[model samples]
Target: MNGCRAKGSWVADEKDTVHYSGAAGGWGSVRGMTEVLARERPTPAALDTLRRQNKPGGFMCVSCAWGKPKHPHPFEFCENGAKATLWEMTSRRCTPEFFAQHTVTELRDWKDYDLEHQGRLTHPMRYDRATDKYVPCAWDEAFAAIGTELKRLDPKSTVFYASGRASLETSYLYALFARMYGHNNLPDSSNMCHETTSVALKKAIGSPVGTCVLEDLEKCDAIFFFGHNTGSNAPRLLHPLQEAVKRGVQIVTFNPIRETGLERFKNPQSPVEMLTGKETEISSLYLQVKAGGDIAAIMGMIKHVLSTEERRWREDKRHVLDVDFLAQHTTGFETVKAHAEQLSWEEIERESGLARADLEKAADVYIAAERTIFMYGMGLTQHVHGSDNLTTLVDLALLKGSIGREGAGISPIRGHSNVQGQRTVGISEKPELVPLDRMAEQFAFDPPRDTGLNTVDACEKIISGEVKAFIGLGGNFVRAIPEQVKMEQAWQSMRLTVQIATKLNRSHLINGEVAYLLPCLGRSERDMQVTGAQAVTMEDSLSCIHGSQGNGHPASDHLKSEVAIVCGMAKATLPPNPKARWDDWTADYGLIRDLIEESYPEMFADFNARVFTPGGFYKGNAARERIWKTESGKAEFTVPTSLSALGLGDKEGRWRLMTLRSNDQFNTTIYGYSDRLRGIEGTRDIVLMHPDDIAAAGLAEGQVVSLASDADDGEHRQVDGLTVTPYLLPRGCIGAYYPETNPLVPLWYHDEASKTPASKGVPVRIVT
Candidate 1:
């Protein structure tokens, strides 16, 4: 397009930056991992913790939710997982003395990376308004103050938020405590990430989770990946993909950016591959679609498949469509087929950024494969029509009878270790999803049946001064959300805010009128309750539930496990209810598991026993067994009429921006400034764009620019001082780091059905 320099010299002006053109996960991953471990200078205890991570009786990795194999490798941890472990198990500590040195106002200005790099927090601290600093506070006093405030405010105005890092046990207890306290406002990380997947899948297949296990990837003849960056988000999944490639499985990927992780991979664990520097090519066909163009791409495939079916039938009286499977196991095929028939090739090509020939090639691959697996991530879900995007994926699968087979199903690659488990154990805003009758009978209290607030709704209430308090079990809630400026301002209006965390974050600096920072033990630390050393359970992306018990020493003597922290809050807030013995749960988490079983018997039956089994047990899915749990007793198709999922027409001087994570980052937790795969270093405040787009906008490379959201909302959402870097992308698409670019997305710009923030695709204009 413009300024055609050598591929490696795009950033010649910046000394610290260089584009990396090597395959993902070889010596580069090794160097990156060494740097990560060297930051903390691995202690003996930390080394031991690494050895036991992802093991049967050891703690789960506090990272992505990629499934574990039946017999995991000794070093089952990925580079990101190592960063997570060492980041938590670091010897450096954020003590009371550290907080005393900096006031809340001063700490608010610190970068998120710097705040977390200070290491694990070691004491419970409360904000001192008069002094503008945090001082040490006893755990009992903090809980008592929180309880008193909760009792004072209306339950409807309070929210209990959970991050995806919590274990299933902690999530269960947290949900129970919130319900016990007479409210169901349980907004969690899922609301921002995969709530669309849950909403769409349940309606289409009667299951909210994936229908495949780790073995499915091995047996599948083909796999289609959409909008997921495996190298940075879930590096562990690369090994299996490499194996699938070796075994002659066809893999196709559709993403706006050509991620290095998905292009080629060199297995770090393979001695021969690493020594010889040989890399395995990942995707057989990589389609660089425009941002938010997945729906159009899928529609094009459907059109090709249908056209082939009609041509074959006319030529030789042969059938190409899975007619029997559609009649027997699915509904709404006629509607989907009719919709595909009317669509013109010109519209599909224009919207999808793919030519008709490329779509036919992809469709041919889909037809040739006996079994195929469909996997997608946040890119497809973080849009105004996110649910529509997922349901459309299901329609294509059903067209080929891809679901309810051994190696075929729709998979939404989830974030965090236990995000899905948290929802499974009852962290939900919808009251109907909970077992209200069983909970009432078991706990001896009338449960609240009113619908609760999601993250976006809670932010709205906080801004309007309607939400009085916020209790975050884990996560940097305010920092990771939209409308960063407004959310930070609204956070001050809360009467009380409690953050149960292991490390310091930006959310802690954005204090409420009365804020308490409670220090909880990290997943890598030993959690010895009254019973003995305790183990918790986590559910992975494959719907497998497994046990995880910490092996290392606690970071601080004053720290407590998450279950204990939940118990302390519950006991202080509620009067003595004989049936709900909160104290017993702290001593023995098995008691909490029993209660979980009582609440959701169908899913969690024999919870305590099955969870400890080697490799864990598969939580069965009815849809996998050809049993439709949908309202019509069959899989249903969804046809979205809009070409642009966001309902926006083409506009000149506009770019659809998708926020992404760097190789050195996980979610909002920034580890370093360098995005090793993208060849970025020294800074994160840069925007990646196609060279043609930059030249078309009359912007020169390395020029400073400002981006303003193109929303009709009156709010001027903009992020300035971003350097323009040329990259390979579609004509009207750009990429920037998340939480930095989150402001450009309006808080109201989200999926109507699921309320998930459209973080992946925000329309913006560049200002020189």
Candidate 2:
């Protein structure tokens, strides 16, 4: 096992942590544009490709799931968007010759960044276990191999995994193909990132999505940002935040790590500000909440609002809790209010790691604002009580009657481009969301009726040799999950593993007894099918359904569209029937949408006409319309009301370790070695620690140490050589770059309800 600092990318000469984060956008963004393009895409034509990103008729950014505005500003793509578009539209290619030159073992030893940087996968390949290598295979041969594997296994034992990058049409067709092949084992990347956001919001709001659209950003009076680092992960969001700030909207940010993007942003889109070196302040009150303490922080705000409203009612007969909305549109308000009132200010301040005065000040702004929106990400959703964390946030939104109105609602900022859409289009393991009976009526196939394995459960089943076939549609699942050391071992035991991807990844390198890599066209690449160059539909974070048509040439002529790949595999696996019409749907994606409309008539009516419209149609959230679908047919208010649930109160020397994404990367993809805004110069090995904790742990700045998990999961989980440096973090808390720190996150350490990996708030002992 290698220490993080011992990796090829780490250099000891580099400083451990930067004192401050750079302004969100400016010359640094331009520098990122120049550097990433020069290294990967080196051509003037790349400029034209970047210009088309997120344009109504052009390709969507392959980075974040942030929605495109109805009236989008000029230069819709952000710094990371440019890099992602160019990275996908790169000139590099991973041809058959490259695989022939490197064995599976040899390529497995290469770094993740290097494997992806090698470029687009040019052809379908099957692993030759005898030769310890992969050889190019004909599309038919690959499809036949998959069919043979599917027939060999009990269809119930087979599992399907989807990444957020898959288009809505592709996702729908995939769901159909998997059911026709005889199982509903559809697990995906959403199981890892925002499952809590979906699961919790659904229970609370009757909608498994954000209640507001991009239009809300324009009119919101105040925004309470929770957990998500908008700058590095979804830079496009900063544009709207900047605009909101200009309109006098107050912003309050809550995160364990104080991201610079939330502090100040200079829109790279504004040339005047770019040249003048001016910046816009993003947060009016930035509270550095303790890792895993968001529940306490949010609960404290709820309590303050309740007390203020009660006091105000006593004084002037004017109320603040929107009692009228709560009485009519919600249930269980009394329970949540009682829970909020019970928590003492001392308990709130201690658990949240914030001064009582600071919490009250934030409450001041929140109470004063007529309309507010709450936006959060993994920081709040990747904890021991992650689902409860989201529940409390929803309760706050409901308490204020913030939801079901323009300029106010809950927005769980998604990590990937179409992850939400993937779930909506039936990529889940849930039996109800999958629309099983409706498919039988439409496609005339009896789909699996039982609930299937999710990502975490799928890993467990695979390890136990219960899962025979593992199929993936984008995403580095093998590495992204916790307990990678065991996951990779379990994955190798499967009878067959299949990857449908645009580029080479570590997951492809870890082959089963028989494995297949089916190269697919990326979002930026043209997918020429029997019909013509096709446009695919994707649902954004805001639930806006729009068309994404690629303008650039395919990375390689041999690459097939994801829909085509799914059809070929389906035709090979299932007995040929005139009724299925797999080929016809694959030939033209519009046919797939027509089927989707048939399945979800209320949501997708007039799908083709609406998806082509400029702004795309909102799928419409019932919660926003005050149309609740709970047991009582009303929105619910839930409060966990436990410090243990909030992950506070630990042993004296223990530190809460939070995994973070560098400004240079998105999710598992590494674009560069440094997080420039954070002042980190060249390495991802550094651990961000509060100065007080460094001294308390008998450690100094730049001291290399290992983090041993406090949880006794039978296995000792640890990440070595995590060089520590003083960072603007709460005391007893530390931050490490994600995926690198993923190993230390125990597989068993997950939210009980949502099963989301508790990547944040990992209790650890700093071993010097």
Candidate 3:
């Protein structure tokens, strides 16, 4: 953090400030598409890659999971989706010659944007210790080397990490392999993003998956978006919100920043909007809540609701609450009700950074609405009390009888397109191993029942030299985690590290004693195999299990699908097992789906036939059916009234920084230096701050400043050359971008319950 460097050109002046006019996706979106079209210059065959995006017989975009519309438009994809597709299907190739010229040390200095832009990796490569470079190797050789390391180390200490971008088939096979190899150490992207939502929602609604589908947006009387930026991260979602606005659905938002997408959106799909430049107003009410102030806002809303219910109950003999629904389907409501009533208005206002009147206004809308959909994103989940915040939101949803009904439930707008799918198909570190008995019966072995490490725990063990080897299915592992340098150094402690990815990321540049880059097929590229060109399955944000078939040919001849790569690793690593036919699964992906059906028979019955159906089938949620399946045979409420919003104490000037993504990028991949939505151009070094705070801190607009995190854990945590820009933000609140601000977050900073890093809100002090 101390020696951090800003890469690339940065053009910002003192007069620079947030200047997005109240509209999104007109010419800006058009410009985004053309920029990639001109730069990538994909062949006519590759251009067809986007034809199948978000539609039946198409591959899922490796971007955000805003859920998919049942009736996908002709241009099913969005701006960010276009970028991801073009980036993946780019003509640029990273040949063996490229690796021959660049050493690990030299490539390490290149920025993330430059590294990935070099293009698809065309061959399997292994690290050469002598030359400190990667040399081309055969797939078998790579798998054998990883197998040798696995055999040399304890399976308990070896962890397998999977990204959400990986197909469901790959995740299923990975879990099967991990169990076959006799290790429960499986951690994936879920631990970093929406683990809190999954864990908390299950307790409240008796389901781990979201209860609503894309169709729910059409019917919901009121839609509340908490801690999400739909316009940038999940662009396709804006279209749905725009439609909802047209239908007069009351949309309320709670976020730290006034995202342009939440303000207004013009659907590029609409000819009238595109031609006339007409925009749809999105949020009916937008509350700029503090980063970790979600729980307070939720509590205040509940407090108001409870009072209204009491008054209504007195006015009429009939109950104001949904007496039948609550009494039959839920437990511990009175306890939550009591706690919310006791919450002082002053405390809620101070913690949430919201006026009580505004909170009351939102509450009034909630009380008036008969059906509501509560949706949230990383803004609420990536906090010290992330799980608690989610739980509190659930409490409000339940109090208003918002859950366990059509068009009324708690949902999370997943950032990664297939991230939630990874979890559904069994990529979990702290897994219940729910079907362990069934798995043992079917796979002919005793699967591990104990829960294993998550993202935070796995990294900690790696830092402590406990984890011997690590394999990532597909993700920028070390780059996305907290304490960037410390975690990067942790890679060197490993005996083996394997990155199964399409492109060369920063993780590939950083090396372990021995490393392997098993180049895999991109999502947009067809995974041709023995059983014809295979189509993989993916679950969208709303738990719709759909088939994603690549409409285009392979990016590189040397590339293997994630299914093939995983099968190869498993065959090399595991002892002979006749029951587990790794070869057959690799040859035919439908066989993988057959095995998945065997694992989750009820949810994925006739997996092959059903997944191919038009919009795919929704995995049945008991909550949506009003059937509770919790410990009490009812959806039990767990009260969360904790005030622990951040790691650093509630002190003035100790600004709460919320890490966000620019429109130019998705996750760790940097697409460009500009965020056109926020009017930021040619620079990512600018930190958005309140105009008053800039003067109070003795700092001027566009003045470059250093940020030192308050987590004083002996190691210095600071981001360099961040130019301060005045903006409309709450006092003691600021905004920073991901990967750049990743170093400022301490390793220990995460929710104790969910273990998700407090990336959305970290306490830091500006060192001018």
Cα lDDT tens digits for candidate 1, 1-768: 122222454434323323567778998888888887888665468888888888777778999998877688878888899888888888889999998899989988898889998988999999999999999999999889999999999988999999998998899989988998888899999999999988999998888887888889989999999999998999999999999999999999999888888999998888999999899999999999888888899999999999899999999987777899999999898999999999999999998999889888998989888899999999889988888888889999988788888888888899988999999888998988888888899988998998899999999999999999999998999888989998888899899999999989989988788999999999888889888988888899999988888888898999989998998998999889999787899999888888888888887889988767777778788999879889999999878857666745568877898999999898989888768887777788888888777778888788889999888667888999898888878888888889888888888889878989998888888988
* TM-score, one value per model: 0.97, 0.96, 0.96
lDDT of 3 by residue, 294-384 (tens): 8889889988988888888888865556778778777899998878878899999988999999999999889988899998888988888
Better of 1 and 3 by lDDT: 1
Rank by lDDT (best first)? 1, 2, 3
Candidate 3: RMSD to truth: 3.3
Candidate 3 Cα outliers beyond 4 Å, as residue runs: 1-16, 316-319
CA lDDT for candidate 3: 0.83
| Candidate 1 lDDT | 0.87
Task: List all candidate RMSDs to the true structure.
Answer: 2.5, 3.3, 3.3
The prediction achieving the highest lDDT against the true structure is 1
Model 1: which residue pairs collide? none
Runs with alpha carbons beyond 4 Å of true place in candidate 2? 1-17, 42-45, 644-649
Better structure of 1 and 3 per TM-score: 1
Question: Where does candidate 2 have its weakest 10-residue lDDT segment?
Answer: 1-10
Better of 1 and 2 by TM-score: 1
Note the clash tally of each candidate: 0, 0, 0
